[model samples]
Target: MLIAQISDIHIREDGQRCCGWVDTAPFLAKAVDKLNALRPSPSAVVVTGDLVDSGSPAEYARLHALLAPLAMPYYLVVGNHDRREPLRAAFPDHAHLRSGPFVQYTIDELPVRLVVLDTNIPGQHAGELCGERLDWLERRLAEQPNRPTAIFMHHPPFKTGNIPLDRLDLSGKERLAAIVSKFRNIHGVFCGHLHRAIQARFAGTIAMTCPSTAHQVHLSLGESSIMAFDMEPPACQLHWWDGHSLVTHTAFIERFDGPFSVQTGERIEIRTDSIHGRAP
Candidate 1:
């Protein structure tokens, strides 16, 4: 029941770092290493979207190299930055990876069923789920009416409150929402696009976005902004159903100064007292 969600890798083949600041590849490799080192490992690792920076074949090759060390099964959905051909070329063995038209499928196992949807709109940064993709989703949901399900995609079906980012949100969300409402067992929706953690409710289920394992979207709440890379470490989300409720935790790995504990009634001293007490 343990699921690990990683998103927005943005790997580039030419070794070009994102925004000329963050080195995404090494950070992602470290994340894979940490995931492998976990005591009770996750059942599967799902990369929500944006596996590559510019849909390059070389980039997909590099992505495979970086992610090869992961110790568990993994799956992916297409994003605005990913090319369907190269993604299929790289992950041809994966059941859900398609080439000609779209990349979408359902992963049904044990306690959960994952419905992967493709929201990528070629030649644009925005997203759309029309034609066959939408019909496919409807059929899948209809087939599994009461199974515990989680929908996975690239673009979030809800807004991120950021104007520019919201501009690229999934189109035809209303139609998608209508279909989702008919299914009662959908646990939640997971996606990637805004480069940060976001949560919302749609069609009686929760919608969530996992932050990148590379950089972050700076929390500038007012105007439209783009790619803000700081010194923040990469992170991921771990989710599981506790037989009654679903719980999620955000995990970050870094070295701290010490493992210190604090208790009530602690004392505070003034530096001026030491100067006054010293013999001048």
Candidate 2:
């Protein structure tokens, strides 16, 4: 099974741009097109949040319109920039969002089980897993201890070297780690909010963060580094499960050079026009 992961879209109202520069809607549209054009299309797409610049009704409505063209079923997770009620109202057909007090649920139909967690703490830029949420996760994990499962949440549990972003790290990470350590069936913990692709060793498995579909957080590793974003290439992550193991690949959304014929040592001439209409 192939699963695609996109994160931190930060869609804005129709005529607005995120951070007064990034027109996120177009970027997301490109991502959707890229996903649809994949040869063996993914079974589902999981958007790991920051779905809009602001958690407003108008923004959510715009987000709904932007995401409507996805060819396959997609799941949504809550992030710091997301508001649960508005998100639920935006997509009434997504029954999973309304499953509980928090926007957390499981996808049982796939060969690899998916457990999505809600780590958004409204009105703040940080993430957390309170006692109730953690307990719920424990119950869910206990239910199928032998099933190959993956966890999805917004905030990464470990502190990334990026100093500024780490300040807003997940609040109950230790307890989370403790719980996760006991689950040998857990395959991986995937998260977003860093706006960059990152990975680290956690409990008994690997935890990874996906890149944003728009602007990316600048890679500055130091105690005095200030928070900033850059126009890095936007991309999505593809997770392929081949019955026993899960492998991941990063797929860039924008068009680039060529896939030359390696066997013939030849280069095929293709359109060099930039996707964003910029000079190459």
Candidate 3:
């Protein structure tokens, strides 16, 4: 089974660049186009969070228009920048988007059980996975004791090595980690919000993040600017479950016309290739 994940789109409705620089819509459109053209494509695409710069009705509409060309099923989660009310109003048809303030659901048909968690704290940059959400997760895990599961959310429970941004890390992480540690069937946790691809270990499971479609956060740890946007191409993480373990690969969207074939069953050694006797 294959799944594609895109995060932190930060779409703006005013047609102005985010922070007066990044044009998120065009990058997202290109990313959608690339995902549509993949051979033996992903079964689904998951937008982890920050789908818009602000969760306004117009922003959602712009996002919808930008992602209209995607050929696979997709879903969204709320981020700190997201407004639950406007998001629900815009995507009323979405299963996760309803009459409530929280958007949480499970995708159970695939080989790996998917648990979507709501960690958005209203009017705050920091996040919390609190009592109600923890109880919900515990019940869900108990129901499928041995199934391989993956938790998807917007804020990672652990720090991603960036000191300044780490201030906004998830609260009640100890509680969440303890619960996940008890579930041996859990495979990994996926999230967004840092605008970079990051990985950390929490309770013995892999916590992975997908890069943003708009701009990347500067890797520098020292903070001179609060936010930075670079011209990095939009990317997505492809997760494949091969019966026993889950492996992830990243792809950047680009435009070109080509027909290609893959020889998947063969292996070549790069060192051997470099020293071969093929000179004339």
Candidate 4:
């Protein structure tokens, strides 16, 4: 089984560029192309969050239109930048897009049950999975104790080490960790909102943050630091489940340079000289 994860699209309704210069549409289109051409196509695509920059209806509509070319079914979660109503309204036909208010639900049809969490706290930079949501997750996790489960959420429940970003991350992380540690079924936890790909060990599971298909968060390792972005090649994450284990790989949207080859059973030589045409 295979699932592709793409995050932080930040699409705009008026078609204006997000963050002043990066046009997300083209990058998203390219990402779709990469997914489509994947050797063994993903069974589904899970967009972690930040579907649109402004929580606007038009932006959601635009996002809907942009991802139409994807060949497989796609699931979604909510992020701080997203509005619940607009998102649910935009994709009412989506299976887990609930009617009440929250977008938390599970997709159990696949080999691995996908537990989608709604961590978006209204009008807040940080995310909150209230007691209600946590209870829901606990119940779901208890249902199939042995089945492999992968968490799909917006704000990660652990510190990312980026000071400013961590400040706006998910709240009640201790409670979340306790719940996750109890559930041995959870194989991995995938998240967005950081805009950069990062990985950490949490609650006996591998928690990974997917890179954005739009832009990347400038890498700052300091515990106290400012936020910035760069034009690093946008990419997505691919998870492969071979009935025994799950492995994830990064799929870049930008076409990399030629995939050169090196022959085996041959002696290679360094041919370059320092600055001049002739050897020293």
Per TM-score, the best of the predicted structures is 2
Task: Give one digit per residue, the lDDT tens place, for model 2 in 57-162.
Answer: 9999988998899999999999999999999999999999999999999999888899999999989999999999999999999999999999999999988888
Q: Which of 2 and 3 is ahead in TM-score?
A: 2
Q: lDDT by residue for model 3 over 1-280, one digit each (tens)?
A: 6788999988998667786778788888878987887655777888988888867899988887787788988888888888778877777667566624467788888888888888898888888888888888888899998998888999988776677678787987899899999989988999988887888878988998888877887775655436555666667888877777778887777654433334654544233223322311
How many residue pairs clash in model 4? 0
Give lDDT tens digits, candidate 1, residues 1-280: 5778899999987558876777788888878987786545777888988998888888999999899999998988889988888888887677568633788888877467888899988778899989688888898899979778888898999976776677676888889999898888888888887778889989888888988888877765657566354556677888776554457777874433433335544554324334423321
What is the TM-score of each predicted model, taking all chains together? 0.87, 0.94, 0.87, 0.91
Which candidate has the top score in lDDT? 2
> Which ten-residue region of model 4 has the weakest summed lDDT?
271-280
Alpha-carbon shift of residue 116 in model 2 (angstroms): 0.5
Stretches of candidate 2 off by over 4 Å are 267-280
Give the true-structure RMSD of model 4: 8.7
lDDT of 3 at 62: 87
Q: Between 1 and 4, whose TM-score is larger? A: 4
Q: Which residue runs of candidate 1 sit more than 4 Å off their true CA positions?
A: 225-227, 255-280
Taking the candidates one at a time, how many backbone clashes does each contain?
0, 0, 0, 0
